[model samples]
Target: MGKSDCSKLHIAMFPWAAYGHFIPFLHLSNKLAQKGHKISFLLPRGVQPKLENLNQFPSLIQFFPLLLPCVDGLPPGAETTSVVPLNQQKYLAFAVDQTRDQVESIFKVIKPDIVMYDFWFWIPDLARQLGIRPITYVVVSSMSAAYNTTMITKETTVEEAMELPPGYPSSTVRFKDEEAPIVLSMARDFGSGLTFYQRINTTFTQSDAIAFRTCREIEGPFLDFVAQGFRKPVLLSGPSFPETKTKQLDDKWVNWLSKFEPGSVVFCSFGSQSELQKDEFHFQELVLGFELCGLPFLVALKPPQGCSTVEEALPEGFEERVKGRGLVYGGWVPQELLLHHPNIGCFVNHCGYGTMWEFLLTDCQIVLIPEIGDQILNTRLMVNELKIGVEVERGKNRQVSKESLSEAIKFVMDKDNETANKLRANRAKLKQTLSNRDVQEKYINSFIQALQDLVKK
Candidate 1:
């Protein structure tokens, strides 16, 4: 099948009930739609309003709402992981899984050519029952995906998982024993006596192929390893890098960043998934860090619900002291767009896969300060494997100190620094690699062709 063969295909997308998962699937849907294919994007009611570009291609893209099922301990408004607190995530996962019947009903009505899903472990079986083949779409680094699939399914002791996989490069990058249980716990057995790992293994096994939100150039080895280990076709769908258009920054932000030279400001954000501890010590440390680094910084942070202003969240006179040196905007800011701005030099990011792609596509120096979950592994890819970024040193408790943060900022943004120059050069090459429209199209077309072939069989 050629590129034109995909025009008649109808693709149904159901991502895990998390913004991180949903957004990537949406990007793929848009790509497929642009090629004249039909896309039915399944979104829970609560998250529908948060989606952008609904009217961009009204005819090709359609939203199909799946009402979140009621489950004990899951709040009514909590449909996406962004809204749910971290501690109660298990309940949210359980609730999302209960939507299986609703999904099946929708599939019967739509009768899609193929169904693509992320982290919905039950999707493969459901698609089979409905006479439609399912494809597992993983929105993570290929190594992380392969590691989880391999380690989680097999009943290996934590000690066994500590050692780096035999063929992987760098023995220093092995998983810590303490991190294994938390990773495994995220994969609830759901009465199947299998960890979340087994569920994913089974799902991927049932599918003819697995689709990843990554390209082969950066992770060719891990991709090959997963395919060989699992004995299934592994397909790359390309990195869904953001399409950056010059967006006008707010006057306040623009005015502050104007004082700094091009590539001198550090943009720090921890995304919506995690938050800095709302305490005097942590807040004071960040202020001191920025001051010591002497780099003008823009931080996007949301104060806790009870706090009315950024001042209430920070230490006394903190804002006054750093008035000209930095910015602390409460709530939203256009992050990807800001990264494209000439004045912004460095990004202190949480290392979410989505954010990682944004950082990769831009010239901004990366200073990874990952908070939780897969971000730690994502950091490893950036700092250890790719060698495009530096990670800040954290204390034994994983709390980063002001001194360490300051040093990291200086290491990346300092003009005469050799290591910093090399990182920028590597990042420029990566940006060029990711910018090839033909390369992206080729990957998407190949993925579509594979889907077409799967459906035909």
Candidate 2:
């Protein structure tokens, strides 16, 4: 397709309000804008601050706000990106419903040629109602898509999922003895997991195409499985890396990082929205373990609601023991910027899809500590299948001891280990394959060409 042909296309992008979902959609949006397609980004109001600087793209891209119904203790006018109590499943459902309403309203006004959405259930029906084609974007690895589709079904109870699938990677697949059944039931009953899998299957069964943020080179086995078995039009767009014009570091954080030797500091952050209670003794064990390692680290610590102080979230005198060796932030950090810094040796992460891609692109070693969701599966792949990282073992109480946490950190940071070096080399090869801009552009352009052909029909 020619540049002039691309200029005539209009695309609307809607992503789930969470950071992990929003960031990748934003990356795709930027790429589309660069290709001369008119792009409209629909997001909840809470994301405005983070998206404010996006206004610079005055010509090709525009942002619109969606209003969400307010709940008590949620900031007034909180949109999809706002942080809420994790336990509030009812509130999260309400937010998703509000997002659907807002998206429909905008679609009516814009009447775009195509609508691209994060894997949300309401989208397929909405697209049908509007006489437009919906493209579902799966943000995780292709393996995740296969696992969720094959394992989750109406007949598959939580108890059954507790047993590892044939050739499943982890010995830790079963939860602690007492909690195993409960965890299985939670996995089965969790509305989001069921909804996500259902939507993905439905979209594969119905949509014009399914788009994924993975290249065939990185996920050939799983991608082949989906294509040969499902026979859907699937496009393997490359990793949607963050594209910002600036590389400036946060001065305060850089100064703190400078105190440590080159490649000596470990960067620890579970992407935003993964929070734990202040009084949870597990929090203290994690802190004590980091202290015991005596590594210079930078941590992003967000205290749970009603925990009025940072001191309440940590072990007593924890900051004093670590002294100037550690720096903790109360709120969000520019993660891509931090990861690309020369001083960061390894990452301790919750293994969100976006963070994993960033870690891969930068060729950094990782220590996976997943708290929930598809993350559990992603952690398994990181350690057992890819051998690129390590996972921490937790006890029956769902907490890691100071001893276990300390040992896991030491294992990941040990430079002389043969396994670690092999993993690093594997990651370097993956990075080289994905760094090809020309190949990435071809996949994206081909997808766009297919959409253009659909418009003529």
Report, for every candidate in turn, its global Cα lDDT versus the true structure: 0.77, 0.69
User: Residues 1-457, candidate 2, lDDT per residue (tens digit)?
Assistant: 4555644678887776676777777787777777777888877766867875654455888888777776554555555444554444435545665567778888899888887776466677897798777777778776666554444554656556555445433354323344444334334322344533454566565666677888777666667666654676677667755454576887987888888787778788877676656555355666777777778888776765467555677777888878888766667798888888888887888888778887887756788777765677667666766677888887766677777776777776778988778878887887777677777778777767776776667
Give the TM-score (vs. native) of candidate 2.
0.86
TM-scores, each model vs. reference: 0.92, 0.86
Question: How does model 1 fare in lDDT?
Answer: 0.77
lDDT of 2 at 48: 65
Number of the top lDDT candidate? 1
Model 2 segments more than 4 A misplaced: 4-7, 70-76, 98-105, 151-156, 163-204, 228-230, 279-281, 304-306, 453-457
Candidate 2 backbone collisions, by pair: none
Candidate 2 weakest lDDT stretch, 10 residues: 182-191
Off by over 4 Å in 1: 1-7, 52-55, 153-157, 169-172, 176-195, 242-246, 304-308
